[model samples]
Target: MRAVHHLRGAAAAAALTLLAVSGCAEKDGGGGSGAIQVTASDSACKVSRTEFPAGHVKLAVENKGSKVTEVYIYAPGDRIVTERENIGPGTKADITAEVKAGSYEIACKPGMKGDGIRQKVTATGQGSAKPQDPRLDRSVAEYRKYVQAQADETLPKAEKFAAAVKAGDIEGAKKTYAVSRVGWERTEPVAESFGDIDPKVDVREDGLEQGQTWTGWHRLEKALWTDKKIGAAEKKLADQLITDLKDWQKRVGTAEINATSMANGAKELLDEVATGKVTGEEERYSHTDLVDFHANVEGAHKSYELLRPVAAERDPALAAELDKQFKALFTLLDKYREKGSPDGFAAYDTVGKDDRKELSDAVNALAEPLSKLAAAVAS
Candidate 1:
């Protein structure tokens, strides 16, 4: 897994070379209002323009693909400036991102996996010269602190989980697995921005690219529970997990964060819940989906709360709707918790069809309004 990390970084560099060789055209500036258009099909990603003045940029993405898609604005070295994931087939989403004047790639992942198809574009003419609102600035500052705190808290728990794995204590490792992930789940987007850490630590089995060794929590998860044994390979992966997480911890403060990204990140958490946690795919072995489900909601709620001051000022109706939806979702999630145990929820497999539908509906309700948050705060 340690070697796998460096290899992925090399692959990103290779992808950059391919982007340049493929003739990514340049344009100075020319586009109208109402969000930059991005068409995502199975085989192609077409952006409306190759360049634009970039202060607060919005990409209006419509997926024409048969598979679900994800869109990202990545700076060089594959740093994610901002991204919108889980854009289902034939659906549309608006991604509002704050970009400084620089070179970037607008990448579309048709199946919501891999590095994605890249289209090189530049942001021109002093893109972020306009000073932001003071409230927005506070939101960014508080959120940055929150991200650092989550990272700080996550590392210790992950270390404990790793210790259990290395000791060949399967039950001990299993007990700490989901708990270790809560901090990471809460602030995943911030960790993911570093470009290379996420795949090493969080990439699921199906999410792996060709020849990419399956590592991180899920890999160890299968070992402790499904495989029912811990070998040298599992022990090595345990150490690698900590190594990757420690890297994330040290770099959390340095992440490129802004007001819109915070708003977008909150929404991304909901998308994470919708696609992975809610689907029962994220913890296929441990059946700890609800723990992750709670953490994702907590993270999303924190981001929304931090940004609420400005978001409410911009669109009070939207803000009110979000407050209501968030409360409703929490209320629904609480019903599943074991008596007297705040963190314990019924294993996902034991969750009936009706209950799962209720949870899914609540997420959808919150997600629809949450999606508009970036625009509200950006305005």
Candidate 2:
């Protein structure tokens, strides 16, 4: 609670600094209408042009792979400009996105996954700034509010969870741990925007190096569930996680949000579920992977909802179809919910391979529709 109050006070104090620059970013969005042709296969990622002036860049992606494929345009910092996914063999689709002047990679994922074959493209000159798309601007505003709300929800839960551990109430901490993860999982993409905070707050035990600061959720999880004790050092780390959460919210609130980011983040959250939760690898100690999975879905759904109107305007049927897919995915997930609440869900080890497969299939089902979102809504 103190953390939340402090965040509100800090936010109010910095209102002028944050809100003054809050509206549409003066970013050099790709507003150009010219289409760049790309061809994808098992061995290659080929593009019609190596570079174009930064503004609105359109791509016509043709997947020649025997298996399903995906293509992405990545900026220098591994930021996703845009991507098109689940293109069947011999299928073609258009991907459009706004890019600033920078070096980028056009990557083709041939077998539907892997570090893809990449070709470099450079945008040399600043193309003229066209007016920001009002729909995208509205989506960005809504996303910011969503992130802020998630952040606000995060601090209090985190504080209580941390306090439980520090007080050596192991059972109480176990109960609170799943409850606290909702905001953290939902806003993970937003939290990861700041370079250092995400690692500090969420990095797994396997990720830690020799003699580095052992903090964040997983470290505490290991202590509570594995070691079955929280000593002075672990207690200190618990307190630090709360303080970091407070600082984390302040930094993320001021960062920019746009269509590509929102769409990419939604996809990334699904990927997070696939890579960690579905694999039963994330909550290795507690086996509470379903909690994170549900939270990620909630976050991704929010991101999609932010773009719903624009997607509806672009193609009404596509929008409606996506809505149906989302509903179906939630229905499938609901069966896994413990006591029919989002906060409680089936333990990871309790789910057999068959159960995991069904969840995976549902996720993949929703992912195909979601993969189209960024490209569809791109200006």
Candidate 3:
């Protein structure tokens, strides 16, 4: 499996292109009352204030680093309320979010990589203590349960695949490999939520840290698909994967949830599709990009479904437009599926360049409508 480290950079570029497309219709400003001034440099993440009155807030971010940076307002439990991305050096951008009274974190990624430097921020107000958007709350809670269920499925299936490798059965491991990824693909954000474990668990060979032992899915993937043999080292990699995923399962069991997370998680899922899955980069070894593509769509659709009520309640026309776009994307995806995969998805190689470009266009269209979702759900 090739290292897919380029996905984040590519996704950031896509986000910027969309931002420019939308900004053509308007201009950004200092924002309204309670706008927090944020500055990012190679060394630090700074905020104008650590406390706010709660409710609607804006993060007016300035990037001073040489590299591209993005700022995120994170709620408790790794939930990011809002974020502004693709801010190059000397660039200014802002993200407005409806934040309730609670503890939060602000993270700045100078190179658009890793967890980033973080600062703590809080909002204080009588209303902040109370739950906002009961409907959205239910949606987030239900989404978390969905994540838990996916985790439950992922752990054992991964174990089973690992078991095959541990037995030195390369064919058996390859047979179960795609099935093992189903849970992890559906609940990717949860894997990403755990600070460092994510890299150890999912980092591709190209993504390995210097001097760090490569013992995860991609490492094992190479053995099964490239080497066509599972050695003792490969078996040990399998053991480590199980170890890390077990931690992933435990951490997600106690994880937090909110409407903002649901909105962003949906975007992240689509970003996965646009960045790696669409290009057939993620499944370089197994040619299983279609499997991941379908899973990403499924996960994104679930996230969008959870936030549909809030968006619809705010703007019926926009909601209908988004629903139509969603169906259009899904209808295109439907053609690729048949009696094949464990989930009935054909391989990524089945699609030609023209079909791939068409699918990519569909993802971009959906992203435009999906970008407005967080604002519509905002209080």
Candidate 4:
């Protein structure tokens, strides 16, 4: 239950960050035609044109206020078609969207409230403007090279730290671990791209002094470095950390290269719960499984943000599909909170076998879609 609680909190934090950056795209003006103008003042959300010519349309969002803001454009049925992230104070970003003839909503998170400010917009008549493909032609190659170097160089240091521990060189292990951890942190941006990699193997968890550190190699470090007896029990624990390190390295190769796939996979996972295929514990108990689930989703979304431009550039249709998946995921997560677990912590074990199996199946269904999406992006 404790583990689960930790993970849920971490997941929430991660999701907020990823969503802020990944989907924010301004609609471009269709072939020099007049574009809709959206302006956000320090106190209000305003759009110059609520109705526009159908086909290709550009949205120019201006943030004249002194705060960071986000704007989201939604089609009918509350479907978000495009978004602008982190529109700094006194700056503007142009987002281009191909608005088919339909009704839409313009949502602005002036302060990133749980519920954002939403307005209705409509498009009518024949329009045929397409969003320019994102510039992935050069960045994709650079990102791939970056990931490869991280795996080749950073993974070995982790291995060295494990070796130091195995040989009973406590001080040496600590030194190596510190160096390795720093390297891993440097690669955090890229590492977030992979679904299989775990930062706990390399990064130190925070709040150790307050018993708040929950995951990562730091968990092992707490056990190893504490002034406890160094008996067979301690040795066994140390061995487990070493094994985990090796296992993590092997899994690194399986990480998806494309960000959109990672994000889509996360979205699919959340959608499963939304559709009622998966059921979590009745109570808000902290469990390792729950924690891992949250962490996995958060990590996946982070990766998606980094590679979003690539996805938009390479395949706009795919990008749109991915956004659909994300909306579903978020909706499902909101439902999970609303439905609050009935049993709480005790429900984890008391649940019937059939129920457990159903839940497990649901989770896997979510994972499966993500895996397929990731594979597509990597390919």
Locate the minimum summed-lDDT window of 10 residues in model 3: 17-26
lDDT by residue (tens digit), candidate 2, 1-379: 1010011112222111111001111122221236677888889988889978877666777778797887766655454444555667887766555656777788898875666899999876776676767988988888888888888898999889998988999988998998887787887544435445666777776655457565788889999999999899889999899988888788766765667667766765675576578888788998888888878888888888988888888878768877988898788878877784335787788889998998888887777667667666763
lDDT of each: 0.74, 0.70, 0.70, 0.47
Model 4 lDDT per residue over 1-379, tens place: 1111122112211222221112223234221247577787667788888887776566777787777887776544443343545578877766544455767778777764433677788878767543433443344455455445545675677667666666667766655544444333333333433332343343334322244434455554555555422345445545555565455455444443334323443443343332222344211122212322333344445455456666566566666665565555444333323123321122233445675565555454444334334323433
- Candidate whose TM-score is highest: 1
lDDT of model 1 at position 103: 86
Estimate, for each residue in 1-379, the C-alpha lDDT of model 3 and write its tens digit: 1124322221211121111111101144654445688889988999899988776566777888899987765555554344556678987765765555678788999987888899998778843343578888788888888888887889889999999999998878888888888777776533334445556766677666568677678778778888888778888889989988887777665554466656665665576578678988787788888877777777777877888888898988868988998899889989988785665777788789999999999998887677667666764
Q: Candidate 2 or 4, higher TM-score?
A: 2
Better of 2 and 3 by TM-score: 3
Compute the lDDT of residue 143 as modeled in candidate 3. Answer: 85
Ranking by TM-score: 1, 3, 2, 4
Candidate 2 stretches with Cα past 4 Å from truth are 1-51, 58-96, 103-121, 128-130, 189-191, 207-214, 340-342
lDDT of 3: 0.70
Error of 2 at 277 (Å): 1.6
Cα lDDT of candidate 1 equals 0.74
Better of 1 and 4 by TM-score: 1
Q: How do the residues 230-299 of candidate 1 rate in per-residue lDDT, one tens digit apiece?
A: 9999999999999988888876676656666566657666766776787788888888899888888888
Per-candidate TM vs. native?
0.83, 0.75, 0.76, 0.36
Give the CA lDDT, 0 to 100, for residue 208 in model 4.
26
Among all windows of ten consecutive residues in candidate 2, which has the lowest summed lDDT?
A: 16-25
